[model samples]
Target: MASGMILAGLGLATIGFGARFIIKQMPTMGQKLAEATKTFPKMDSKAFANSKYYKGGFEPKMNKREASLILGVSQTASQQKVRANYKKLMLLNHPDRGGSPYVSAKISEAKDLLDKN
Candidate 1:
């Protein structure tokens, strides 16, 4: 009977030790979870849905330098060359051709800016 009691006491002590170890690790586990969340934030679906391209009224004014870069032309390119490049880029980036509307809009804006300048 005395040996059985000693075995039961040891079993209870082991369980208590295990519980204490898990309780001590709880804060560390929570800290790791918080750090992971900060490193990779959840995506905001509403922000993506509110893009100007999705809204259909986005008219971004392209600058001369940006326009030249977008069209892959030199800033000193002649009007004819700019127009040709613009046509080529539009053919490649048009939304109807499986391109993104945002990219197509930017290309159109670039052409307008280059033509105006």
Candidate 2:
């Protein structure tokens, strides 16, 4: 009974506020969750990417400038373009699709680094 009343109140709120109810912030919450869940490999797991495409050998922790270079974006590229490039690269480096997980992780780390700026 109380749950129904809460839902009813939510419906009223939707009607009053043009459909923005308590669930309206779900996407933001999901985005934050995704950001929180982003992971990069530890140094213990970093060696031997052995990717067909990556000939650079063992890499250290990614820095801002290196991240921009890894994503193939300019130092001044907008976040939108950075994201676009990240997606494009991920498509080519996704593990199940015959790409390297280490490379994928590095790519993701690069994107996160670039997005921060």
Candidate 3:
């Protein structure tokens, strides 16, 4: 009976610790969500749903980070690299090169938006 009581006490302590940790982390998590919502328009579900890129027949949704990944460039890459990556993707995805124009157009638009920001 004593051992069971000790185990129950330990479990309760662990639960309290976890609750405190979660509470402390909540503000940081909320701040991160707010920043993401403000900074990445692509992350907005409704806006993304209505985007030209989404309407263009892409199989999956692409986020800002995915856009950077697709172009083979850093999120902070300069305008020059952005242009270069766009050209590279154009070559790889150009309709004449047997690539889908829809995908190519999405890539081009992603690059353009990333460059502007």
Each model's lDDT comes to 0.82, 0.84, 0.82
TM-score of 2: 0.50
Off by over 4 Å in 3: 1-62
- Scored by TM-score, the top model is 2
Give the clash total for candidate 3.
0
lDDT of 1: 0.82
Report the lDDT tens digits of candidate 2 across residue range 21-106.
53697899899888877865455534656545645553587787788878889978999999999999999999999999998999
Model 3, C-alpha of 103: deviation from truth (Å): 1.4
Q: Estimate each model's TM-score.
A: 0.47, 0.50, 0.45
Taking all chains together, the TM-score of candidate 3 against the true structure is 0.45
Best by lDDT: 2
Looking at model 1, which ten-residue stretch has the lowest summed lDDT?
52-61
Q: On residues 1-117, what C-alpha lDDT tens digit does candidate 3 reach at each position?
A: 999999999999999999999999999999999988888645456756666452433337656677786687888889999999899889989999899988898888779767887
RMSD (Cα, Å) for all candidates, in order, is 10.8, 19.5, 14.6
